[model samples]
Target: MVTSQSTESRPSLDYEAVIGLEVHAQLETESKMFCSCSSGYVNSPPNTHVCPVCLGMPGVLPVINRKAIEYTIMTGLALNCTIAEQTKFDRKNYPYPDLMKGYQISQFDQPLCSQGWLTIQVDGVDRKIRLNRVHLEEDTARLVHKDGPDGERYSQVDVNRSGTALMEVVGEPDLRSAEEARLYLVKLRTILQYLGVSTGNMEEGSFRCDANISIRPVGSQDLNTKVEVKNMNSFRAVYRALNYELERQIRALNEGERIVQETRGWVEAKGITVSQRSKEYANDYRFFPEPDLPPMVIDRAWVKEIRDRLPELPDARLARFISQYGLAPNDAVVLVNSKPMADFFEECVALTGDSPKVEPGQRARAVGTWMLGDFSKLLNAQGMEIRESKVSAEALSEMLGLIDNKTLSGKMAKGVFEEMFDTGKSPGRIVKEKGLLQMTDSTEISGAVAQALESNPDAVSDFLSGKEQALTFLVGQVMKATRGRANPAMVNSLLRKQLESRK
Candidate 1:
């Protein structure tokens, strides 16, 4: 594995940064990878979900789930990988309590997918990262430990997670920064959302990653003794782990200490990678062909169908939003990050031209703003998914339409949106029920403006005396007098008319 060496000369070892990531995503299939047991048996009485196949009991055989295979192939194509025509399961022998069968069923030597690439925006620059392989494997059981005060400790095993299909995507050592890793994950997770594969929820332990970080010279072509980081549960944790490992390796090399080639666990709270044990070799796993299951041969027609089924992915969608809707890159990223958000935005467009403020172009911008800005907060506070959200596209459009039609102030419309989300009622019903019709009529607005001028002669005098912002204060008072239902645009118009009359 010899390659070109680093050219940056320094007093110490010229170390550069190198990272490769292995992500394990739990497939959204109904059953476990190799058995008929349910995959959603979380929090059940530990071993209740276990069956003969998952328990490694004798006289029971495991069967391959076709959905898992399709999911693996779909994920492979999403990574821009060349799916292997022939693939199989291999036994990775180990003696851990979590591995009930005395070995873990995984892919080795010939995995299902390989040579894929993932492109991500790192620090506003698009970087294309290479993928080594994405393979299908079975997850092991849970290993929990309980201890008492007097050092009395016991170990317990739960087989519920056993046989759960997992896809381990191995990235090439092309990532240079922690930001790059996080961006790559965002891109990868978005694709999974489009594919309807994994939930990509790191909090649920469904999607997890391990980062391998090492440092070499700035211009180094040769790699370093990379250390694998485990137990990172989220994208933020992955970024933190790589940042910590890079600094740690730099200090070690600065002091002339060697970094051990081994696996380390990410201490998220402490923000460091703790050395776990000596490196486990490939031979230690004792790779062998699975005795029960046979090899998988992917057909051209099936592959063609999967390729055809892929939706217009995130990057492409983001570009379209930019070009078509004239949204900023950041706004486009936020919208396309979640499927429902993008769908909700489009639905709003169908209801109210495009943007909220203007007929079409401005309306899209307005909708994007509210959906990303205030509405996002409202949804988060209610702990509601956009699809499950009580606020319908029609309701939001009606609310924005009121504002666009000059029938409601922006502030009044916000109040309407809040009411709409809360009661699942249309904005008109809430407005009519609360008597919040905006005072946009000239007669009503003129009467309120005259009252404000007489009530605050000094404020009118201040406006005439050249303190122009005093007019803003006067207009605000008019709005307050009208119980916030008065249109600000009308208030400004009438206030200025009265103020100019005073002069």
Candidate 2:
């Protein structure tokens, strides 16, 4: 049982964590890497999608998936990697229950892409994490562990995912903390999603990560023995696992225990990493050129075509959001980090037309405020993504329009927006059905202001004596009396008029 020590209880040490990550994203190809087997095997029954080629049957020849190669190159270009004009596949000899072929055909010395870097922001500082290589490989089958009725543990092999195209993004050890590692993963995942090469969903095992972490004295120039941590399926898990492993290493070093170079599994429930096996070196796999498949000669025209066709990435979109929408830097960063959210934001902005009443920049800022404020609050409370929300971009724009036209107060619109999110109803329909229209009528607002002043004589007296806060109390009274339907500007104006007449 592994336990985590709280920061307050842990001893302070002059150490810094050196972390690197190997992320495996299963490509969104239609078929397996070397076979025609369907890659859409996530929902299929075990062993149903397997073919003789994926099974490594004797006398079976494997063919490469051209689309997977293209996707890998696209990913490399997106990461600013150097695409290799010549690349080949090699056999990685390994014995595992999940390896259907007893060896994987993967890129070894000659990867399709190498020498890339991505920028990640941590603590408001931008750091570029270097990429060692981005290589293509086939995924192994899954091992399903089950408990037998007689209290015995047994494992079964599911070959459905055996031959799926997998891209391994190996990062150099440039990270100094768990937070940096998490940010790096997030940036990389965002890039992958923008490229449309992978779903980048860690929960579904399409995007998986294995982290190598070690700690050295803060001023040390040498790298220490690192432990590879696996089984972390989420970003939060990765952060926690790395922090825990860092602390564990610090404690071990303090106690003069030798740090072993080994692979460990992150126990999510225990919040600690447990030793699994010794780390394997490249020679352990006995990598050799695979004779079954031929080398790939990528064309410069193809690379240029893919690069030209690349969509607007997160960083570029961030800058555009700031300049195009006139949004604040922080607000634009948050929106552009998630592609779906950013797309939804642009859609909402587009629906909000440029009129004298609502300028384009004003409309964009208003949409950003709502999206980053109450709309986000509700979505988070319900655990829904922007694309999965019941509220459409059109509906949100309509609600903002109501606010702009003074048909609904900001408070009233909050309720209307909540209803819109809940039932997927139009803003106009919800407003009409719930009688939540703003009380813009001067006569009606005057009456409410008068009643509030007559009832709250002490507040009125306080206002007469120059208490600025008294006016705020009276405005709240008016809003409450009108069930939050009164236009706030109208309420303040009417209240000030009535209060001045009293004085």
Candidate 3:
């Protein structure tokens, strides 16, 4: 419970927020964690995918999914976690309607992975957020609350999600701000996606997060009472919830109020956190070794094999993009954040090939600029991913080639790109159909420059009177008169010679 105090004047103290995140990523497996039921229950009817084992029927034994275990270990290895040699399952005893078996089989003392750290950058400063453990657990069923027609509320249990393999990555309290927490989650999701172990879709509940946050005075070594926030389904929601909780705690402390240790639910509509229940501890769960399952030892050779199969992750790809392609660090970061986008960038660069007219670095930068600029804008406007766009990497590479050859001016290329994006047409077809080829003929450009000079005499006079920026205005008039078809260098050269003749 959170209590509010009187708004009395008190000395403001600088405080820092301590945040630790517990992220649960549903493993991508064909079957359930401890059952033979289908894990692809997202679009299936409620309880249709469940079996006797998942339904908690009596006289049933649960079997471990070897693929799930391998996936967990793969994730641990990717996170740089040390794999545990010996690990076993324990029954977490709790009385909840969502728990079909009245207990959850999870790791306790020894987890599958431990003592890992993830690096996240904020404001160009890198901070390593340590991991307490990356363990495996079984997810419980979902509870759907609804209002009855008779003005009563009831809940329905959807057991389709029961028995799913869930990998929990618990972080140490190394995050200091909401931005850092968001970055940490984003980075973790990217890694999971790269590994192909999970979808990492927060909207679909494949990935979930619960944040434990507390505020302490700056330079303090002691811990304070922390509040756990839940029900944030998106990265933006998580960032906002943490920020609200941090400010709430700081305000409460400043007003001579105490922060209570409790579980809070983030009401995104209200933009506030409401009390849920008292925070539960391990003792409350009464966790103990399950008699039904046997203890097993993880083999070192298997761990090494899983590590060997790991894919090139985000950080590695980012570095390679910078070193091999000569991209700016910031640009590389944006491209590498999304694996598909990064792949698209590389594909375009590869298709660009070795051309004497354009340097490799210049070609890379051009691809990066288009992908990050107009391509990104149109994709975002239509709520589409890079892979979903009509424009292919080959198409973009061809468009860039046209720009290098001066067949299309920069402005004309943009118009061609927009049409290509909308209609899936090639740049060559668009340019030919629309007559957008650059007017590189010096005679035609010189005539257009003369027309612009005749139409905007004040601008011409301004340029003649030593106003250097007046030439830029005159250049724009010529481009507009030519429908952006004139080669900019030709326009500039013709305008400068014509202006010098007038002088």
- Each prediction's RMSD to truth: 3.7, 3.1, 2.8
Give the residue spans of candidate 2 off by over 4 A: 1-13, 277-283
Off by over 4 Å in 1: 1-16, 149-151, 279-283, 353-358, 381-384
Per-candidate clashes come to 11, 0, 0
**Which numbered prediction scores highest in TM-score against the true structure?**
2
Q: What lDDT, from 0 to 1, does candidate 1 have? A: 0.85
As a TM-score, model 1 comes out at: 0.93
lDDT for each of the candidates? Answer: 0.85, 0.91, 0.92
Q: Of models 1 and 2, which has the larger TM-score?
A: 2
Model 2, span 356-410: residue lDDT tens: 7898999999999999999899999988889899988999999999898889878
lDDT (Cα, tens digit) per residue for candidate 3, span 164-263: 9999999999998898999999999999988999999999899999999998878887679999999999999999999899889988888788998888
Which pairs of residues have clashing backbones in candidate 3? none
Residue-level lDDT of model 1, residues 1-503, one tens digit each, is 11223335536454556888888899999999888999997778888778899898877888999999999999999889998998899999988888888988899989889999978886687889999999988888988889978999988888999989999999999988787788888788888887889999887788888888887777778888989889988888888888778878887776667988888899988887899866454448779999888888899899999999887888889888998888988998899999889989988877765453475767888889989877999988877778887888888888888888777888888888887887899888888899988877888988999999999988888888899889888888888899998878778988888778778
